[model samples]
Target chain A: MLDQKAHKPHERLAAHLKDDLSQVDEMIRARMASEHAPRIPEVTAHLVDAGGKRLRPMLTLASARLCGYEGGHHIHLATAVEFIHTATLLHDDVVDESGQRRGRPTANLLWDNKSSVLVGDYLFARSFQLMTEADSLRVLQVLSNASATITEGEVLQLTAAQDLGTTEDTYFKVVRGKTAALFAAATEVGGILAGVSEDRIKALHDYGDALGIAFQVVDDLLDFWGGDATGKNIGDDFRERKLTLPIIKAIARGDDEERAFWKRTLEKNDQRDGDLERALEIMTAHGALDDTRAAALDWAARAKACLDALPEDPIRDMLSDIADYVVARLN
Target chain B: MLDQKAHKPHERLAAHLKDDLSQVDEMIRARMASEHAPRIPEVTAHLVDAGGKRLRPMLTLASARLCGYEGGHHIHLATAVEFIHTATLLHDDVVDESGQRRGRPTANLLWDNKSSVLVGDYLFARSFQLMTEADSLRVLQVLSNASATITEGEVLQLTAAQDLGTTEDTYFKVVRGKTAALFAAATEVGGILAGVSEDRIKALHDYGDALGIAFQVVDDLLDFWGGDATGKNIGDDFRERKLTLPIIKAIARGDDEERAFWKRTLEKNDQRDGDLERALEIMTAHGALDDTRAAALDWAARAKACLDALPEDPIRDMLSDIADYVVARLN
Candidate 1:
C-alpha cells in the first residue's frame, strides 16, 4: 500500500486525460460566472480552485475516451458532472455545518449559510443547463435521477445519521444515494454520450457505483484512522454524532453496556471527555474497523471488475487502477 | 381594482382547470414519495397540503390549455412548477429562519433546518426529474434557466437584503429572479409544450413575468399595510431590514435625516423603540406606499396586455383576470 501511494492513479489519469480535463475546467469557470450576480463567481471560484481531485469529472472524461467518443459533448457532460459535485459539496457543507473543505474554509463559512444554500442551488441548475446543451435525453435522465438520488441519500442520512438501530441495508442505501448515485451517473452519462452499448453503460455505472462506495467507506474509515491530509479532522464524524459505517458496524457487535455508550454519545449527543478514545477502543475490540476496511476492499475489487467489460485502453486500465487507489489509502 | 376582487379570478381558473390541476397534484404526490426515505413524503405533505393557492402550477395548466395542448405532459410540467415553488419555500423558510408558513409551523420549525434544507434539495431534484420525464428539450432549457434565475435572485437578495443602497432596478431584478423567473418559465414551458409560435411563447413569458412581478409587489405591500389574513406579520420585512419595493421607493426619496435613520435601522441593524412605526411614517411622508401600489397596478396591467396575443378562451380570460386580481388586494 505504501508502494501504491507513489503510483498516484489520479495523477496518471489526469495526465492521460489532460485535454478533456482542461476543457472541463474551462467550461466550469465559464459557466460558474454570472452577469448580474458577481458573488456567484466569487463563491464558486473559491471551491472550484481549492485543489480537489476532480475525480468525478475525470471519470466522465475517461469513460468517454475509453468508449471512443470523438464528439465534443463529452466536455459538456464532464463539466456538468463537476458542477453537480461542487453544488452538492456546497450544500453538504451547509447541511453538515462544516467549516472547512479541501484544507480551506467552506463556502458556508466564508459566505453565509444563505449564500452556500442559494449558490449550491444555482450550481445545480447550471449543471442541468449544461447537460441540456449536450442534447442527450438519456444523459439528462441519468443525471437528473442521480441528482434526485444524491439528495434523497442526504435526507436519508439525516434521518439515519445518529440512530443506533441503523442496519447495513440502510447504510448501503444511504451510500448509494449520497456517493454512488452521482458516480454511477457520471460514468453512465459518459457511455451514453459515446452512444456505447447498453452493456458497456451498465458496466460503467456499476464501476462508478462500486468505486464511489469504496471511496466513501474509506472516507468514513479515515475519520477514525487517517490524518490531517484528508482535509477533515480525524473523528469529526464521531463528534458530530454521525453513524457512518465504522460506528454502525461497531454498534452491531456491542454489548448492552457498549450499546448504552453509543446511545449516549451518538443518539443523545451527550458526550464527555475521552468519549472518542473509548469509542475507538470499542470499535477496535469489536474488529469493526478491520471489517469496514475489508468491505471497502471488496467494493474496490468489484469496481475494478466492472471495468473489465469496457474495451482495453489506457484510460480503462487507469480507471481500474483508480478503484484500487480508492481502497489503497485505507491500507 | 376593488371591483376585481369580487370576481375571484384564481378560484374561477382553478375551477376551470380542476381536472388537470388535480392530476398535477396526484403526480406531485406520486413523485415526492421516497421508498427508503419516508421523511421526504412527511415533510413535503406538510407544505403541499397547506392550502396554498396553487397559482404557479395553475398558470402552467391554464397556459397549456389555452394553447390547445391536448398532450398529457402539461401535468408533469405543472407539477414540476409546483415542486420548484414548494422547494423554494422550504429553503426560504430556512434562509429566513421563519417559524410559520400558511398559518402552520414551517418545515424547518416542525422538523429541523437540516430536514428543510435537504428536503428542499430533494424536491428541487425531483422537479428536474419530472421536467425531464416530460421529454421536451425546450421545456428543460426554460425550466433550468428559471431555476438558476430563482437561486441567483435569492442569492442577490441575500447580499442586498438589508442594504440601504438597493435600488428599484435591483429590486425588480431580484423580484424577477426569485418570484418572476419561475412564473415566466411556468408559462413559457406551457407554450413550448403546446408547440405554440415563438411569438406566442414570448407573450406567455411576458405575461408570467409581469404577473409574477405584480404578485410580489402586492405581497410586499401586504407586508406593511395588509391585515392578518396575508399569513405574514405586518412590518416583518421592516423588522428584518429587508429592502422590498416600498422600502426601496422610500429610500430613493429619503432626505439625509431619513437616510441616517435607514442606515441605523437597516445597514447597521441598530433599532430603537418604534423603528417599524417610524419607517412606516417616513414611507408615508415620501408617498412611497402610493408609488409602490401604482407600480404593482402597472405591472398587472402589463400582464393583462400580454394575454392579448393568445386566442380567445376561458382560460386566457381567467389568466388576464388573475393578473388584475393579483394587485386588487391592494385596493
Candidate 2:
C-alpha cells in the first residue's frame, strides 16, 4: 500500500491519521508562536513546515488508541514528541554541517549555525512545554527517558561517523538511542496516559521499539539503495561510514583483501568512484542485504506480535499494517 | 548583612537551601551517568563535577519548599532545570568561542564543538528525563516554558551583540528569557508540585522572575565596577560590545560625538585601550551604573515583597537575603 506511492508514505499516514494529524498541526502552530522572538517562528517553520512522515506522533496516537485511550492529551504528547524530534534535527544539521535534508536546504545551511542551534533550543523548550501539559508523571518519565536515549544515539553517531571498527552492538545501541527510544517513549507514554495495565504497556513499548528499529534498519538500507523514491544516493551511508547492519555483515563475510578495502574506506574515509558499487557487490554476494531484510522483517513480526496482547481495534489493525509497511520498504 | 565579609549573599542562600542543594547535587550526579557512551559520562563529568553555585537548582528547590512542598521530586525537577542551564552554557561557549567559564576551560575549548554539541544534546535528553520524573504536566510546562525562554534570551543576546541601540526594554526581555525564565520555572514548578494555590504560585514565579532580573542586572553592574572577587573583568561587557543596561543607559545620555564614539567602540567594535575607561566614564556620568544598581535594588525589593505574603520561615528570610545578596556584589 505504501509502495503505490500515488501518495507519499507520510501522506498516507497523515490521511489515516487525518483528524489526529490536523489537531496536532494546529496545536504545533499555536505553541510554536513565541512573544519573545520573531526569529523563532522563522527557524522553526523551516523544519516544522517541512514534510516529514509524522511517524513518531502516529506511533503515539495509534498506540494510545489501540490501548483504548479516550483522553485528548495524547495528541499534545504526540506533538511534544514531534517537537523534540524536529529540535534534534535542527541541531543535527548544525553539527553535521549538512547541506540537505529531504532534498532541501537545512535550517543551518539556509540560516546560520547560530540560528539553528538557538532555535533548536527554542523548539526543545516548546516540546517540554507541550509534554508538561500532559500532567501525568509517568508520561513525563517515559518521554524524558526517550529524550535522553535520543541524545545518546546522536552522540554515538557523532564518533561512529568516521570509525570503521564500530561493532554491531554499538550500532544497535545507536539505533536504540536515536530512533527507537522515542518510538518506545511515544507509545509507552500512550499506555501510561491511558493508565493501561503494565503488561499491555510493555507489549506496546516492545512493539514501538521493534518497529522503530526495523524502520531505522530499512532507512539505513534505503540510504544505500533508495534512488527512485527517497532520492538517497546508493553510497550515502558509505560516504558517511555509517557502519550499518549490511556493512557489518559484509565485513564478516569478507576475505582479507575485501576486509582491507572496507578498512581503508571506512576508517580512512578514502573513497574511489567504484567503491560504493564494490561494497554493494560484496554485500549482495555475502547475502548481507538479505540478512538485513530478514532482520527488518523479524522486527516487523515482533511489532505485530505485540498487538496480540493489545485490544482488538481498528487502531490495532493500522499498527499491524505499519509494521508490515516498515518491512515492505526493503522489497 | 549582604555587604559583610563573612556573610556573602550566595552563602546565605546556600545555607538556606542546604537540604535542597544536597538533593539537587545527588540528582545531578545520578542523572549525568550514561551506560552506552562512555564519552557522555566523561564530558558530563567535566561540568557536573565542577563546583559551581548550584544556584539554578537551589532556585527550583527553594521555590518548591517555600510553597509548602514536602515531596522529593522537586529535587529531580531542580536538577533537570540545572541540567538545562548547563547544557545551554556548553552550547553558549561554543557559539561565543569562549575559553573560560567560572575559571575553567569550557567544554568546547577543552574537547571540541562536536563533543560539546553532542554532549549538550545528551544532557538535554537527560534533563527531559529528569523533568518527566516530576510526573506533573504542570511542572513540565513550567520547565519547558523556561527552557524556551532561555533559548530565546540567548539568541537575542547573540543577535543584539554589538548593536548598541538595544534598549533597556530589550535588555530586560533578553535577560528575562535567558536567566529569569528558568528561575521563574524553578519556582513555579515548586509551587505546582506543592499543589499550592495558583495565586501563591504566581507569587513565587514573580519572586523568581524579579529576583533573576535583579541578579542579572547586578551581574552586569559588577562587570563594570566590581573588583577581582566578582570574577569578571570590569568593562568586559564594553570590550565585547555587549549591550547591557549600563551601555544601553549610556547611549541614551551620549551626545552626537559621544554617540559616534560609542558606535565606533560598540557597534563597529573598533575599541582601543582606554575605550573601556571612556565607556565607564559615560556610565558614571549619566548615572547609568547608579541607575542600574537602583533598578536592581528595586527588583530585589519587589522580589522580597512577593515573599511577604508567604508563611514565615528561615527559607523565606533566606530568599529575601538572596535578593539583597544579588545586588551586594558591588560591596
Candidate 3:
C-alpha cells in the first residue's frame, strides 16, 4: 500500500470506464443546470462540483453502449440515474445525523438540515425530469422502480440500525434495496432504451447487481479491515452500531463471552479503546474478514460471469474489466 | 365557524371529490402495508389512517376522470402522487416544527422527527414504484416534473417565510409549485393516458391549474378570516411568520411606520396579541382580504370556463360544479 500503488487501483478502474464515464460526466454537467428555479443551479452545483467517481452513471452508460445503444437518450437516462443516487446521499446524511461525507463537511453540516432535505428533494425531482426526456415508458419504469427500491432500502437500513439480530438475509435485502437496485436499474434501462433483447437486458442487470453487491461488500470489509491508515476507521461501523456483514459473521461465530462483548459494544454502540483491538482479534480468530472478502470476490466473479452472454465489443470487454476492478483492491 | 356550519363546507368539498377520494383511501391502505417491514406498516398507518381530506389525490382522480380517461393506470398514478404529497407533509411538519395537522397531532409530534423523516422517505419511494406501474413516458414526465416543482416550492416557502417584501408573483409561484403543479399534472395525465388530443390535454391541465390556484387562494383567505374554536387555529399562519397573500398585499399598502411595524413583527416572526389584531386591521383597511377573495373567484371562474372546450357530459358538468363549489364555500 505505497502511495503510488495505493492510487493504481483507482487509475486502472478509470481506464475501464473511460469513454462512457466522460459522456456521463458531460451530460451531468449539462443537465444539472436547469433554467427554471435559479436556486437549482446553485444548490446542485455545490454537490455536483464536489467530484464523485461517477461510478453509478458509468455503469449505466457502459451497459447501454455495451448492448449496442447508438441513441443519445441513454445519456439522459444515465445522468438521471446518477442524480437520483446523489440526491439520496444528500438527504440520507441529514436523516442519519451524519456530519461528514467523502472526507468533507456534509451538505447538512455546511448549511442546515432543511436545505439538505429540500435540495435533495429538488435533485430527486430533477432526476425524474431527466428520465422523462427519454420518452420511453419502459425506461421511466426502470428508473422509477430503482428510485423506489433506493428509498425502501434506506428505510430498512434506518429501522435495522443497532439491532444485533439483523440477519445476513436482511443485510443483503438492505444492501440490494439501498445500493444494488439503482445500479441494476441504471444498467437495465440502458439495455432497454437501446431496444436490446430481453436476455441481454437481464444479463446487464445481473452484471450491475452483482457488481454493486461486491462494491458494498468491499466497502463494509474495508471499514473493518483495510490496514492502511487511510481506511483504518474500522470502529465507526461498530460505533454507529451498523449491522454489516463482517459483524454478522462474527456474531454468528461468537461464544457466550464473545456474544456479551458484541452486545456491550456493537449492539449498544459504546466502544472502549481496547474494543477495536479485541473485535479485530475475535474477527481474525473466527475467520470473519476472510469470509467477507471471499463473499465479495464471489459477487465480483458472478458479475464478470454475467457479462459472458452479451455480444463482444470494447464496451463489453471494459465492463467485464470494471467488474473485476470492483473488488480487486480489497486485501 | 361553528362545527355544524364547518361540516357543511367540508361535506360539500368532500362530496365533490367523493368517487376519487374513496378510491385513494383504499389504494393508500393497501399499499402502506408490506410484509417485509412490519414497522414500516405501523409508522405509515399512523400517518395514512389519520385522515386529512385526500384533496390532492382526489384532484388527480377527478381530473383524470373528468378528462375522460378510461385507462386503469390513472388509479396507480393518482395514488402515487398522493403518497408523495403525504410524505412531504410528514417531513414538512418536522421542518416547520408544527404540532397540529387536520385537528390532530402531527406525525413529528406523535413520533420523533427522525421517524417522520425516514418514514416520509419510504412513502416517497412507494409512490415512485406505484407510478412506474403506469408505464407511460408522458405520465412519468408530468409526475416527475410535479415532484421537482413541489420541492422547489417548499424551499421557496422556507426561504421566503417572513420576508415582508414577498411579492404576489413569488407567492403565486410558490403556490403553483407547492400545490398547483401536482393538480395540473393529475388531470393532464388523464388526457395523456386517454389518447386525447394535445389541445384537449392542455385544456385539462389549465383547468386543474386554475382550480388549484383558486383552492390555495381561498385557503390563505380562510386562514386569516376564519375564527378559532372551530376550523383549526386562525392566527397560526401569522404566528409562523408566513407571508401569505393578504399580508403581502397589506404590506404593499403600508405607510413608513406600518412598514417598520411589519419589519419588526412579520420579518421577526414574533408578535404579541395586539400585533395580530393590528395586522388584521391594516389588511382590512386596505381591502387586501377582499382583493384576495376577488382573485380567488376569478380563478374559479377561469377553471369552470376551461370545461367549455371539453366534450359535453355529466362528468364534465360535475367538474364545472366542483370548480364553482371550491370558491363558493369561501363565500
Top-TM-score structure, candidate number = 1
Query: Candidate 1, clashing residue pairs?
Result: none
lDDT of each: 0.89, 0.80, 0.77
- Model 3 C-alpha lDDT per residue in residues B73-140, reported as the tens digit of each score: 77787788778878888878756767877677887667656567667777776777787787777777
Instruction: Provide the global lDDT of candidate 2 against the true structure.
Output: 0.80
Clash pairs for candidate 2? A132-B137, A135-B137, A137-B135, A140-B132
A1-331, model 2: which lDDT tens digit per residue? 2335524444555566678878998988888877767787888887778767778888888777767789899889989888888888887876666778877899876777778878877887777777767777777777767777888887888767656677889888999988899888888988888889999899989988998999898888887666555656667778877789889888888999998999899987789889988998899999998898888899889988988998887667778887898778776
> What is the C-alpha lDDT profile of model 1 across B1-331, one tens digit per residue?
1233345988888878878988988998899999889999998999999849999999999989999999999999999999999989988877786312223344355357778788888998888888888998889999999999998898888888888889888999999999999999999999999999999999999999999999999999999997576889998888888899989888889889999999999988899889999999999999999989999999999999998899999788889889888888987
Candidate 3: which stretches are off by over 4 Å? A1-23, A34-36, A98-111, A227-232, B1-23, B227-232, B329-331
Error in Å for residue B239 of model 2: 4.1
Each prediction's number of clashing residue pairs: 0, 4, 0
Name the candidate, 2 or 3, with the larger lDDT value: 2
Kindly give the stretch of ten consecutive residues in candidate 2 chain A with the minimal lDDT sum. Answer: A1-10
Report the C-alpha displacement of residue B264, candidate 2, in angstroms.
3.6
Candidate 1 structure quality by residue, lDDT tens digits, A1-331? 1223345989888887877888888899999998778899999999999859899999899888999999999899989989989989988887777888999999877777777878888999999999899998889989989988998888888888778889888999999999999999999998998888999999999999999999998998999987565888888999988888889889999899999999999988899999999999999999999999999999999999998899999888889889988888976
Chain B fold agreement for model 1, TM-score:
0.93
DockQ of 3: 0.49
Per-residue lDDT of A307 in model 1: 86
Candidate 3 - CAPRI tier?
medium
TM-score of 1: 0.95
Deviation from native of the Cα of residue A262 in model 3, angstroms: 2.3
